[model samples]
Structures are given as C-alpha cells and as structure tokens.
Target chain A: MPGVKKVGQRTIQFANPPVVMATASIVGPKEGEGPLADCFDKIVQDTYYGEKTWEKAETKMLAEAVEMVIKKAGLQTGDIDYLFAGDLLNQTISANYAARQLAIPFFGLYGACSTMYEGTILASILVDGGFAEKVVAATSSHHNTAERQYRYPTELGSQRPMTAQWTVTGAGAMLIAKEGSGPRITHATVGKVVDQGIKDPNDMGAAMAPAAADTIITHLQDTGRKPEDYDLIVTGDLATVGKALVEKLTQQQNIDLSKNYTDCGILIYDPSQDVHAGGSGCACSAVVTCSYLLEEMIAGKYKRILGVGTGALMSPCSCQQGDSIPGIGHAVVFEMS
Target chain B: MGANEGSLLDKQFQQVKKQAQQQQYQQMAQSVKPKQTWVKNAVAAFLVGGSITAFAQIIQNIFQSAGLAQKEAGTATLMIMVFLGAFFTGLGIYDNLGKFAGAGSIVPITGFANSIVSPALEFKREGFVYGVAAKMFTIAGPVLVYGFVTSVIIGLIAYFFQ
Candidate 1:
C-alpha cells in the first residue's frame, strides 16, 4: 500500500502520474498591461474579442485556449479523450458553450475561482487512473463578465474598496496526458469548503485565506512535506491580503509557508497597476499557472511547485442575504519530469 | 465578572463562532485586509465635489449675465450640468471621474444624471426595450423611489403639523 494511489485523507498520489503536455494562456488588454504580459500565449486587444458581448468573448477565449493547447501538443481534437472546463458565469455558460464548440466529452465545473486547479485535479485523476489517455483542463474568467455578474455593471462608477480584487480577463488550458515530455502532476489535494464567516464580498482574499491555509495544511500533513520541499507554492487569486494571511496561518500550524509561497493574484499584476488588492477569478490562477509557471517549469526555474487554487464561494444573492462567503482550495503538485 | 463570564451555552456558541472565524487567519486577514484611505478619499471628494459645484455656479452666473432671468439661469444651469454628465458618460469620461472623485462626483445632480446615463448606455446592447429602458433605472430607480417616498411622507407630516 506504500505506492497506493490514495495517499492520505485529502490527497491522492498518482501511481501513473499524468504529464502536462502543453498549456495555453489568452489574456485581455488589461491583463496584457500587467507584468506577465509577455508570458501569455496571446494578448487579446479587445475585451469583446470581436464578439457581441463580454460573455461571448469569454467563451471565445476558452475555446481558443483549448484549441491552442491541443495545437501546441501537435495533437488533433480527436486525440483529446475528455475536456474539463469551467467559468464564473451562471450555469458556467462559457464552459458549456466552449465545450459545445469543442465537441469533446465535456465536464462542466463550477468552483468559483478555484475551477482551474479543480479541473486539473479531476483531469489528473482520470488520466492517472487509466481512464483516459489525453484530457484537457481549461477555465476562463472575464473581468467584465464577472464584474457584471457578481458585483455591478461594467460601467458602474462606484469606487471599489481596497479589498476588492480585480477579476482577471483570461483563459488557460492544459493538456494532461498519459505520456508527455513536460511537468507531471504527482499529487493532488482535494479541498473542503471551509467558511470562516467572512461576509464582505469585497474582502474575498480574507474570505479565501483560511480555506487556502486549511488545504495547504492538509496537503502538507498528508504528504509529509514541508514548505521547503517545493521550489514554489502558490495560491490562486488570494492576492496580497490573502497571501499574507496564508503565511501567518500556516506559520501557526508550524508549516512556515513564508519562504517559498506566493500568490497568482499578486503575481499577475504589479502594485503600480492599482488593481486594489490584486487579481482574483478562475483565470487569475489559470492564466498565471499556464503561462509563467509553465514557462518557468520548462526552463528548469522551478523543479517542484504546489499550486493551490483558492475560491470564495459566494453569490450576489447570498451576499445580499447576509450569508458569509465560504471558500475552498484545491492543490495540485507539479514536478518537472 | 471574569473574562469568561457567560452561560454554558453562550460559551459554547462563542467557541463555535470563533472556530468559524478561523481565529488566527481571520485576525491576520482583518489586520491586513487593505487599509482604507479614508482621509485621502475625503480630501479628493472635497476638492472634486467643490470644483463641480463651483463650475455649476459659474455656468449659472454666465447664463444670468447673458440676459437670462435668475430662475431661468438656475434651470439652465441644471440642464447644462445634467447634459454635461450624460455627454461625459457617453464619452466614457464621467465613469473615470466618478472612480476618482468618489462621493464628490456622486453626490451632485450631475452624478444623478451619470447614474442614469451610464446604465442606459451600458445596457444599450440588449436593445432599447429590455437593455436600455429596463436597466436604465437600475441605479437611479432606488434613488427616485426613496426620494419620492420620503418627500411624500415629509409633505404629509408638514401639512398635518400646519
């Protein structure tokens, strides 16, 4: 049972680890102005992307990202056994519509901002379990669409508080296969929905920090690994506030995530951009991981990395009804093969 | 009373709530959740809001000096300010100003025009009926409803008192 697939309570160690064959990141104009502008596969000049609306643009981004990932792997669409995709829209219309166009076996997911790692975890499970040979995990989030759906109309002149994170307008896709020459997903940690009674929607980082800490703690305990074991550890969309909170929280658990830890939200945009706290959304992690992390891993900059996708599970109605924001964190360990 | 003074059930409830708060994480998050620049925002509001009002007054004075009646000048000033608000909103300038000016831009009549015009222009894509007409009042609707309600109630109270 030492090499057993089920490693611990919350983590699964793949006996046959799935390789990340390729990754593609497509970001909008605002994200293009960010520090990781050069890292993206394509920097779209228009939020509409020649589409009718921002939502449709998000759909196009996800579809193009999936197509681009498959192309980068030099594989046909028929080569991909299954496609896992999600977005922040209600009913995950972006994922569904994108899948509708892809014509592959699709799994529509909704984990808020954590959908990227959530899809990665699920895809890895399928590939590692000998279910499918090639599975592509893709997720997207548009700044305008997310803003209109969750907060306010895109053109609303209301000043967002400092804690409010700017939703990233981008899409990321990764082709995970049984055999590939790239980083392999070694261990996957499934996070539980952890709510800390944080009610402020603007303070998503605060809401998600505890959940990220919980998952990180669980992954560490289950794998018997320390913070120093990984070259880099990142939490998705936690931004500056959540990153700091995760550090202190993990320190309390004696995990000490300070030295090797960073956040996608903090990484995607520079402080000079005035993106309030930072970036948050499914694509915030998806884009950063698929682009910067993928490139760095391939360049041998990071040997092993832990990506924790953190999501605040709150709806506009729930927030309005005074329900606190519950959050989840899904972690995927990637090591250079 | 001792620091832990409470009923047994209260103590239990407090414990549960504390657990939900994820004590350390929540405290750390609260401590670092991005401090609001209250003073800076206030200063900006004062400067921008005052400037807008002064500009409106200058426009009114201009109208009056142009041989318009005092009441006509006041009415013209309101129209021009609202026109400017809507025009700038269409030009996509008011939103940017509103983002920076905060309450300064929002507390004025121009802000009210912006509140209405912004949604109308944004939702124009859904067509004039549902998109523009329906969503036009999204921001301004509440203000109109509450304003009218309060005014009617105040008028009734004043009439009864008199």
Candidate 2:
C-alpha cells in the first residue's frame, strides 16, 4: 500500500505539548549538605565496599530518589512502564539498583555529567512515540561514593588541587508523563561528543567549556532561536572555574549565554556555604533540574528553559595512563505552551 | 556535759592533724627528679614537626607512582600534609611545630591545602550559616578575586597590544 493510500482520511500535525505532571526531589545527608554527611557515610565508610566500589553509593542514592519520585507521582511500583536512568559509575549501578527496586522495565544509559539530559531526552521520546504512557528518568552521584569507587578511598588521604571539583554527593529524579499540565519538553538537540584532548582533570572547567559552547551555539542554530528567547540557560556542573571559561569562550563565537546562563555546579552550593568553589556530579544537574528549575517553571517565573548537560570524558585510569581528556555535552529544551 | 564536749572536740582536731602529716610525707616520697630541660622539649617538638612534611612527601611519591597526574599527585600529597598538620594541631603538637618549623609545614603545597580545608571544615562546624555558608568561600575568596582581576587585566593588555 502506498503511503497516501494507507492514510486516506488521516493527517499528521506537529504541536508542542505541555508536560502534564512532575514530582519531588530527595537527597541524602542534610538538605543543603553533601551526601557523605549522612547514614550512608557509615554504611559505606570504613568498609571494603566504601573503599573500593562507587556502585554501592550510587545504588543507595538512586533507590532513595526513585522511591520519592514514584510516591510523588501517585504511581505504584508496577505502574511505571519503563525506567530510564544513568550515573558516573562503571556499569551505571545507580540505574541498575533503581530498576531492581522499582521493578520497571529498564534501559541503562551513560553520559557522565550529561546523564540527566540523556535520560530526559529518552523519556520524552518514549512519551512522544506513544510507546509508553508513563516513564521515570533519574540520575545520581556521590562525592565520597564516586571517589572511593572511581579514584581513591578516604583513608588513602588524597590531596585535591584548586582546579579539582568536589563531586556533589546527591541524586535527582523526574517523572515524565504523556499527559501532563507542566511544561512540555519541546525539543532536544543531541550534541556530538567533542574531544579537544585536554589532559588535565584538575582544570576540567577549561576542558569541558568548549564542548558546552559548541552544543549551545549549535542548538540555537538548529532551532533558529536566539539567546533572548529563553529566560535562562542552565549548564550542568561547570562549577565556578568552568562557568567563567564558558562565558569567555562563547563570546568568541558571538554567542553570549552569560547574561542568561548559570552553572548548576555554582548554584548548587554557596561557596560561602563552605562547599569549596562549587558542585560537580550527575546529581548536580539532576537535582537542579527537578527541584530548583521545575519549581521556578511552575511559578510562572520562566516560560521557556534550556538545560545543557556537560561531561568531561576522562576516566581516572585514562588520565593516569597519560591519555587526553575529551569533552562532550547535550542540550535539551523545555517550553510552556 | 561540758567536760565530755571539750574532749570530743580535742579528738577531732587530733585526727585532722594526722591526715595532713600523712599527705605531706606521700608527696615528698613520690616526687621525681627532673632529667630533661625545656630545651629538650623544644627540640623534640621541632623534630616531630619536621617529620610530618617528610611523611607527606612519602605519600606523594606513592600517589605519583599509582598513576595520578602531577597536579593530582600534588593535591594528594597536600591533603596528607594538611591532615598531619591538623592532627598535630589538635594534639597541641602543631603549635610547637608552628613555633619551631615556622612555616615549614605551612610553606609547601600542603600548606595551601591546610589553609583551604581547615577553614572549610571549621566553618562547616559553626552550622551552615556562620559555618558552611559563611566559611565556604573563606579560603578560596582571595584566590578567586585575584584570579578574576588578573585574568581581566591580562586579557585587556593582550587586547590592547593587538
């Protein structure tokens, strides 16, 4: 059957839909504190698991976040049709454990710091495709947890340079539904992972800012949108160091997101709040998107939002082997209609 | 009745006098002869203080060998030094070290780590506002301010030269 013959009386149309529903964020330790300050510190601390694997910490964080998101969405454990999640761990154990507890059909994803955007994009696609009525997308990371798993244990007494970011120990979850009254995820621009082969992990802000700028500029170009079109453009975990670099580099392309752009890494922790410089982690972007940004959107404070998640694609092993650090970023747009 | 009361008071006074005499004798017998002078104590403090930096270097070597980058290795070394310094500080050992070494512990890259982490951990104790919030940027404030100013100046100079 020809295409026109198969749908003689049907027509296709494109419309921007509203996000019908969203939910709460749950974090460890104190509300404004790092996760290591909590009970998990004791659970994972002084143990072989705490000293060896980040998987345990990621699992604990995701379990807590998923529980909160599911309860808030008024859905039961079995109600979710699919689970899309990611983290910075080797096998993405955060998503794995969350899937085990939630018992939803699962797809594990990884984009390093950009995991949240990757999950959100997939969730939106699932909803738009009519493949699922409800999908839960979540991501999380812990500083001590990731450190022990990915780098060194606390007992090892490793020193941190001025350029190194204190990985934020936290998690964030969001429930994306096909029929919701909240702001719809209108469009997403997938970024090509770019590597300038910068080697220093201590100066990650400089390493990743160029990739962030590339994605932001290209997203605007593809969508035929200008910076002024959105109220704010938020980037994932650039911290104070990266935030400055991003602003400076973007100006070279005549694309200035600085006036409206803010970094999740900087906003998550008040430097004066004793968090040292700013926040970094998959959770940095996730929590800010679900809690801070979502709240602002609901209040009519912002009509349109652009969230760009950036990741530095360098592993401890990779860096140690004298390999260059490649950078990657993904941009997703959400609008209220 | 008056005769009996006077005898009772005399008995109590006699008992107190015997107790004081016994205490004095015990103190005299227990006292030890002094061996080392104040100079020895000061010298001991110096040795202990200097050892911490040496220990930190040992740790840095291990980190370097383990495949950490130079900056990362340096940071790890500094963290160990700061921790050792703080430990000594808590034990009142660092005070003596600070006096004797006089920035020996404070002058190295490790000293930089101590300067940042100590204030941060201290402010963290005061509660979020005065503690974490107020002190979060306590150490990094100067670095950031100076960094920003210097970068701008450099950028402007470069632009003008061009």
Clash pairs (backbone) in predicted model 1? none
lDDT of 1 by residue, A56-167 (tens): 9999999999999999999999999999999999999999999999999999999999999999999999998899999999999999888877876666567999988999
lDDT for predicted candidate 1 compared with the true structure: 0.91
Q: Is the docking of candidate 1 incorrect, acceptable, medium or high quality?
A: medium
Give lDDT tens digits, candidate 2, residues B1-162. Answer: 998999999999987886574354223212321222356545644674467667777887899899998899988777676666556444444333443444455455444544555454534434767855676555456876998999999999999998
Q: Docking quality tier of candidate 2?
A: incorrect
Compared with the true structure, model 1 gives a TM-score of 0.95
Give the CA lDDT, 0 to 100, for residue A33 in model 2: 53
Quote the lDDT for A218 in model 2: 77
- Which ten-residue region of model 1 chain A has the weakest summed lDDT? A148-157
Q: Each predicted complex: what DockQ?
A: 0.56, 0.01
If chain B of candidate 2 is superposed on the true chain B, what is its TM-score?
Answer: 0.42
lDDT of 2 by residue, A168-217 (tens): 66677778888867878877767676655456676676567767877887
Q: Model 1: how large is the Cα RMSD against the reference? A: 3.5
RMSD of each: 3.5, 29.3
